[model samples]
Target: MSGTSEGPTPAADLNRAVITHSDLDAPPCAEPLPYRSVFAAAPLAMAVVDPEGLVVSANATFGALLGTPAEKLAGSVAADLMELTSDARSWHSYREVLGGRQARLRCTRRLKHPEGHSVWAQVTVVPLPGEGRGVLLSVSDITTRRELQARLRHLQMHDPVTRLPNRTLFFERLTAALDAESYERGGTGRIGLCYLGLDGFKAVNDTHGHRIGDRLLTAVADRLTRCADEAGYARANTPLVARLGGDEFALLVEHSTGTEQLADLAESVLTALQGPFDLSGRRLSVSASIGVVERHAAGTTPTALMQAADTTLYWAKADGKSRWTLFDPERNAHRITRQALASTLRPAIERDEFTLEYQPLVGMADGTLSGVEALVRWNHPQFGTLTPNRFIGLAEEDGSIVQLGRWVLRTACRQARRWQLDHPDEPPIFVSVNVAVRQVWDSDLVTDVAESLADTGLAPHLLQLELTESAVMGSAGRPLQALQALSDMGVRIAIDDFGTGYSNLAYLSRLPVNVLKLDGSFVRGFQYEERDADRPSPADEVIVEAMIQLAHRLGLTVTAECVETSAQASRLRGIGCDTGQGWLYSRPVPPDRISELLGSPGVRTDVAGTP
Candidate 1:
């Protein structure tokens, strides 16, 4: 090759010839041919851009991505193809790569296409290895993948049937709101929740198929969402309505004004659900019970809030369905205490932490001690001494009453036997023990009483088993047979707390009951002083008189309970009540005190009201 004035010199030409020969001899196709083929046929849309961000070269794939011809893309700014390039932060990053400060840059962006369809592109740019300092760009369409991921996320956070936010998302949003409120200055904003359960939903599920139930749930969700939207309009942080699985739904309201607003929302929800639902030509009516809890977000957690809501919901159901109940701290504390006592009840029985106190059942005619009622008390380590009123219902609920009742029966019999042994001269004083309804049904009461009497050498007649009037009236089959067997075995069965339950006097004639212990309510009216000297005895006194006469006719002795004052005692005595048991005579005292009373010659008639 000859040297030209404006072209390569002889040495330069020689160098060029050597480089071309090396490239031709190295491999089969070692030139730019393979790279060009890959750039042309690659699935990814690719381009080359100059330092100013203008497109220098574009491939067919790149043209197809933007809905333009490859030749027409040249000289156009590459940033213009990406919708997000207009953002300051995105533009800054783009400038960094184009200025050669960044070796490579990758980002996801929305790309505008001429076909009027937007595309999501994962764009990657790297500096080209040449003097021009251009960048090679690659774009991947991730629209379908992104849409699929979004759908998966929705499925995870929403209920499939109701299409409402599920418990997971509800908790997440609640947590987020709580966190945000915590970071606020001064006092935190209040947060409120409405936990709702559909009443008689299980009935619907049982009567109708699950498919119809599902449809009903969907309809309920729609109605709830509309109510939530309406309630949340004037409030900040729109309430998040969610289905917490199976006929239970929740509404989370952040930045609550007060309980008034929450109450309004709850009322609105109740009203919304009042209308009957039309499901596939079937009209179904349903109601809901809502528990509303509102408090400042400072010390609240998602779990604690939800727990309070759950407790309140239970109260709503208990108080009667189709109503809303607000969270009351005092009531919740009482419930929690009851639950703690319940959890410790079985263990208490095992540990022998129970003790019996006896209150004298005295003769109203002579004001002398006749028998003592065995009242069980729990010597709880944590709560000190607890009365039956605090824990008896709890024991009955957990089915611990059977064991507890047996223990009481055996203990009372043994104590009564001891008292008789101590005072051989004194008349045999009976020990009346209260029997729970569950103990009657779940336990062999006749056997228990017989064994106790046999073990202690005490007569069955001295160990009276007192059952509530309801228990006696409701007894049938085995329970009735058991009662009859006990009655035949010479064990006295007194109907306790008479007139407090279904007072069926006709049914009383059938039961083998020997005594009727009138309920405290009948005696409470006698507590009031006689304001007018000429006025007739109070209605309660007349009722007591009539009941006493009726019991006398039935050959059943009548005992007055909870006589707090001497006046009340005097009236009960005047009404022909056979016996009296109350704080007026003596509070429930330990066994030793009872021994002293039994040994004393004259009856201790000094009356003292309950403290």
Candidate 2:
């Protein structure tokens, strides 16, 4: 060893190095006295290494551990014998101990025995006590402890029935693959997953026994493993298949090329499972729905990836199961927005985040604005103004439609009363509010209506209630009685989206309905003109004319919805449609704009609109 100009000989330098690291001021012996006979008979595997790393001496136990005679073990490299040279960090520490700089070095190593068996050994090194400049090395056999730990880990990380990696290990591998340095060793920087569930697996358990289900799961796992093995036979890294409890399984692909690779894997799995599985004397058939997601691993978390996979799996089931579905961010975004809106809907009403917009319903015969349909708009703070189509169904599904309907009724009535007061002479154009079936079933709709009329001082005749044609049919219990009671109060009851529902006019005539809003499908046919303007599209005209005549006989006035063109308005008016409501008049406009429209003569005839 070379020394600096400020230092003495290398021997003196090593002595100082050894002394500096010692807890007590222990001094190094000038020279090795000699080998002791006791060392050869020691029970532990031990050896002596000189500063240069050559084995100066070895006990019989150490020689036996390496399958060599004690005499021949001398002069061999101690690091090579102990297999410490394989790890750069451990080898460096060993050299430091031999140089009298480090106090001790300890690490575990797997070493091959002379019998061709490998065993885990914990190696420890320290400066020789009375031997000059050399270090003492000892190796302890920890193979039993290591094997126990491995067995415990296997039990913890694998599923018992399928003998495959469980959810815990699946997530562990997923998190590792999503790590920034996952592919630093060099490969494509993408991760993929094929999350699948057995279609109608519950039915299998219900029809059969759980033992059969477990055996079936085991069979599925074996097939999945074979698929994965076949897919990876030519590649260095193979995809990992895991059973995530129940019948759900996941195949994680590390360093995936792209979605194409995942798609291939998912398709192969689907095809492989197409064959039937035989357990004991029973042969059973099963299918899987797979959700495949593959993307650059950068900036992705385990939770995010799993969520995307879960959502895609749902799409597969929705798209008629036993197939694979790839993730579409656009569709996912729409669903996310819908969920956000649903969560905020109930609170939005309390937050005053709702506003009313009115679309004028003009009398087709005279072009007079007979009424305005009050449509509710959600002026969400985050998503901006959203129409009924975006959140109405969600609200209905979650039972929030009751509260929302009440708000719309009161707000529309109040605004209608204000318009009447603003221009007292103008025949108060009635404000029609749409009602959902859930509102009638879930709430005291009659009391809500009466309260709104009383609170707003709006006349019952001036406020019309609209229910879908489907909702109004088969009206017997509360819904039918509610309609009857509302009609008795002079509040006109109209069946909305007519001509698309049951179309049972007899059953409808039995109810107290006063109006029928023909569905837009019936009016859309008249939007384009036929070669002979004298004969409108008869397919549509015949349907509309017959419906209008039947409705007239039932004494129910008709309103044409989605009336977009002047030709459409004229044709509907010619068919005796009592009123027409659509873009032809105006899209739903703000309350102030509706008031402005009322001051004019009428829409469609007086106003040329293209919305």
Candidate 3:
């Protein structure tokens, strides 16, 4: 080695020619411009080892990596100076570089310095353009670089909180496997996915804040990871757990043994998650619902597989959480239809496809119109005009009930104002609107009602809100506060569908409620009789009498709902029911029809008839 120094040798003096074996075999026609300058000036830590594994020359960085002087590096034997530990089998692997048979030999091994400090290096041996006498070696102290790359890979592919592969990496692996299956010589290929949701996760998040919720999720991930590790497959194919988001997670299983195997894995996951999470001072219980979708003989597309998993997961939730459900094409079709409907609802409202009809509430005493309950109808383009009974329950579940409820409030308020203006002296019959639980929670009910009243100039007293007893009873915290605020503004509050809820009469007086609309179930009992006459059935008279007395005691008015016949009306009137609304009076009619009935007392009296 010429000019053995501390810093890298000047590049101008270094060899720049790419040596070819054919040229090396031809001659040494020029002065021996030894490749020593090229080795010393190289950016990578480069060296040349003779057949005896002695270092002939080393780059500046190579000497620095080994903490040895570049001059001293030449005489040292490579194997003697370095400590090597690796899984790669043979030292002869490096000879390929010398004979120009192989391009490189890369291995991870520890390098021992003269000062006794150990360093990790990624050692690469490449054939120098020389005779089979010496080989070129490059050492990269990749400890920091490799560790950094490992950390970066972890951050990119795994969820920070759960340490599970995220959707991105999972999908990438799935797509790769799917591609491999496409070209494989095997007769057919299949992939399975298990979509999972944590049951009662929201309740836990609600009871305990997000911190504990995260801990619980971490615990769940750990359990799933353990299961994945225990699975016996070349790539550890139990399931690739991924947190899609929130309480939802998914798993990808390849070369699945069929539906039975997938189901067994799902069962294992559920069993693993069945235990309680001891999160920082909080013991929270959680279970998982799994939706399994196995590839059919016709094969599965990635989108279809994921969608089937999603649909099946919903089935698991619907079938009552903490269980597994297999994907069925027919069931998914129904779910897709419902999802389509839900997505279209808001746009329908925007397109002026919704309308309200008025159902008359008749005063039981005089047989006259006391008020009209505004019922919503959706004139859906695809499904035709749908009644509240068709979609109200679904709307409430999807949280679209809030927007729908607002529409109903505004429309009913506007109609009541019009009715008051048209009739001027008919004592201003109040218009009632049903409030769903979702509406109560999602909207500032007080502001909505107050604003509706102001916008339509409808009297607060003439605008009654009918909340189902369950809706009212389940309300607490902000919901109860909103209802109380509405009551303070002079709006009447009525509990609709009363008897079906828990009979907590204690809530009646305390909840600012003014009326209770007996549920139609109890009212139907007045006329229907059970098979065994000896055994008393749920009697309407007994329930009505008790309710009426209870209402009086609580200073609330009682209304019997679904009163259809003269006999039921008579029974209700005799029992002191203040108001009644049912099909007998008239079904829900358009605004014009309501006006027609209000204008003609003959029609009202004749409609009341024998009742």
Q: Which segments of model 1 are wrong by more than 4 Å?
A: 1-33, 46-118, 123-138, 181-188, 205-215, 234-236, 278-284, 505-509, 527-531, 534-538, 605-611
Using TM-score, give the best candidate's number.
2
The TM-score between candidate 2 and the true structure equals 0.88
Return whichever of 2 and 3 wins on lDDT: 2
Task: Flag clash pairs in model 1.
Answer: none
C-alpha lDDT (0 to 100) for residue 56 of candidate 3: 74
Q: Please say which candidate is ahead in lDDT: 1 or 3.
A: 1
Runs in model 2 lying further than 4 Å from the true structure: 1-42, 50-56, 96-103, 128-134, 527-533, 605-611
Distance from true location, Cα of 604 in model 3, Å: 9.5
- The C-alpha lDDT values of all candidates are 0.84, 0.85, 0.76
Q: For candidate 3, write residues 269-353 as lDDT tens digits.
A: 8988878778887777888888998875345567777877887998898999899999988877766767777888878878889
Whole-structure CA lDDT of model 3: 0.76
Mind giving the per-residue lDDT tens digits that candidate 2 earns over 1-611?
11112223332333335433241223334332223444556677877677788997788888877888988988998888887778778877777778777677778888888799987887877776553558778777889999999999999999999999999999999998888887676788888999999998898888889999999999999999999998888986799999999999999999998888899999999999999999878899999999999988888899999999999999999999999999999999999998899889999989999888899888887778889999999999999989999889999999989989999999999998999999887888899999999999999999999999999999999999999989999888899899999999999999999978899988976899999999998888764455676657767788889989999999999999998777787778777889989887788888887777676776643355632
Task: Name the 10 consecutive residues with the lowest summed lDDT in model 2.
Answer: 1-10
The alpha-carbon RMSD values of the candidates against the true structure, listed in the order shown, are 8.7, 5.9, 10.5
